[model samples]
Target: MSGAHGRRERPPAPEPLPAPTVDAHTHLDACGCEDAADVVAAMDRAAAVGVTRAVTIADDLAAARWAVQAAHWDERVTAAVALHPTRTAAVPEEWFAEIERLAGDPRVVAVGETGLDYYWDHSPPAAQQEWFRRHIDLAKRIGKPLMIHDRDAHEDVLRILREEGPPETVVFHCFSGDAAMARECAAAGYVLSFAGPVTFRNARDLQEAAVVVPEEQLLVETDAPFLTPHPHRGRANEPYCLPWTVRGLAALRGVTDERLATSARRNAERIFGLADVPPAAHPWTGGTDGARSA
Candidate 1:
């Protein structure tokens, strides 16, 4: 149902997946989660649909702190801290220190949602590039994966990564590229995380790109509170909506949903070290419907 201003209502939860999956990138804080209980309820909904774990991204200092707290509060949630390229324009240089401090937490699994966002000119290109390099350095020094957010500046992003030498593992969150770019990233061994847009009927280029990604390097995300997948596009989104995206991607890749979910789960675990994390005692850990992950 449409609500005020005709904003589409949240879609009903889809059928649970055939196997466990992980929301490789998201923003629980943006999904209207205000406290531990909200976080728990969000994860509970995700767990119901076989999304066993999630990496909540922080785009600013405040979000970074909240992300870490969420990670520690609910074992199923993990954090990625950074200043989004758009936000980098106005934030003080000193704020980055807070991001760095938060990044060191064991609960924080990655350093990103950073990188260039040329599409939004909120930040001058120079400032965005400068901070992108700094975030890269932070990831390298701390030995965590660097999650990128390249928009309309893929070549520059790659060039900078090569210039500074990329961290051991790098991920392109909400990867928006065609087949050729996919090949370039795959060749460089950078993980590509497809989000809800992959389910859009008009996203032929992205669909083609998704098919070409090395199975091992492929990932899926919600990027929720935005980019809600097809049949429900323009609607509100959350981790629970991941099934539609996963199912769509699986179809494009010529695989069963279970196979894709299993792959995404394994890839996310390896990249984020989610396997070692234990969920809250009372909640379902990694499971399909009510069944636990093995």
Candidate 2:
């Protein structure tokens, strides 16, 4: 939990924005919320700052199941499920079937946090690409958006997405590409979901990339418990800190705080198909009965 300067805690919440928005991607589990009550408290903090809803994503099967229950427990949360690229190897075969089954649940909104991660050599590039294609196909089959995590493998990610044919709604989570790459993604109609990295002073290229994404193709996320934006970088992050990233993005895109929030919310609704209606609840109380019934 420790970050730069040996700090292990989050900073005070920034000033609230004037209108509500959705954190397109976040990881409530990594934030260490122990149970439904704990998750709701985190949501309350975020809602207080105009971040009224969030899509909690999973990096592996175990987390995906938790994400599904978390989403059903609260209307303000949605879930995205997928195996992280680095952790793809060593997973049991049933895990893939489980993920495919979970994808059918209305509470599970997207298939993601999936894609290549060349930054780490944990998984071979071939395995990552193979799993990425599987997830992409799954997203297409389920008719849900595809949330990608492309770290240091932009070209390969884009190439595979093209080769497999991207889903109707494709989102690049924590988009770290330059303006040219952003334009390439935009041309292919991919949504660029910016995270805390866009707020760093040295991320000028990323900032410029943010400016070119059409309002409808733009999104903002906390990617909570990591990438805690500028001025508070390295502090443990939670959804309440989204406003820092939102405001920073607004400054880059030359829009008012309310305008950016409004557009981001609209984009989230359109892509995720929420449109103000939460998915039907499929609550699981940690037993075979709930899982079986669902």
Candidate 3:
């Protein structure tokens, strides 16, 4: 379906990967999934292309609730819960408690999609930093990874992490750093999850950074319903499009798709612990009617 503004149509599903891997970060809610049925269908589509699992992220309260529920709806889906930095600029203090409680759920593997975003002033730097620190502490307390959303504020993000003494596991989602920043992140033993932009012709800096990342600290994602890979750049994205990214990243580093995909899967399993868990639920049948469970 095309949007009234002439938005590109959804991209066709890429070929199945030579090996299965996981999309380290994505927003199922933002993808327009509203319930169990929606979650099931999405995972099925991903699994068909060897993208066996996904870590759905929530950037707000409504999304947090749905993401958690989505994780349960399909065994293939896990979740991360947090308020986005932009959304944190001015929120009630009580909201953080609820996020914390949700973050504690066993199904929630990370606390983030949160960090600094100087690109948009939807939130002030001060407020975003305050919430970012709280999330940093929350991840430390819960002992889960911290998935960051650093935009134009890389230095501040790094400084704050250093100041607060970041949690044991830190991940920079859709990392936008150059080789220097990538080296800093890698040297600090942080994980760098790359998305579609690394494949773009003008993304030389990101591509350079991609080359420097160690295998263990490397991860891949679609960040889908957004950032569709090359050949599908302007199209709507989904987890099914992950292999395109895996293939793109592999070529950028001068490696075969299978080699990169294997490492990515291993790293994802190590970080998110979502290794080859077979789906327990059937696919969604809800375009127009009845739904089914596992």
Q: What total of clashing residue pairs does each candidate reach?
A: 0, 0, 0
- Residue 25: error of model 2 in Å? 0.6
**31-60: candidate 1 lDDT, tens digit per residue:** 877667677888999999899889999988
Model 2 scores worst on lDDT over the 10 consecutive residues at 285-294
Of candidates 2 and 1, the better by TM-score:
2
Reference-based TM-score, model 3: 0.92
Candidate 3 structure quality by residue, lDDT tens digits, 1-294: 113212336777889999988999987766766667777777889999999989999888878877777776777888899999989867887888889998887778899879999999899999999999999999999889999999999999999999999899999999999999999999998999999999888899999999999888999999977888898898778888899889999988899999998899889888875553344333334553322221
lDDT of 2 by residue, 1-294 (tens): 113422359789889999999999998878876467667778899999999999999898878888888888778889999999998867687999999998777877789889999999999999898899999999999898999999999999999988999999999999999999999999999999999999999999999999999898999999988899988998888899999999999998888999999999988988888864455474433443323112
TM-scores of all predicted structures: 0.92, 0.93, 0.92
**CA shift of 182, model 2, Å:** 0.4
lDDT (CA) per prediction: 0.87, 0.87, 0.85
Q: Give candidate 2's error at residue 244 in angstroms.
A: 0.5
Candidate 1, residue 208: the lDDT equals 97
Which of candidates 2 and 3 is the stronger one according to TM-score?
Answer: 2
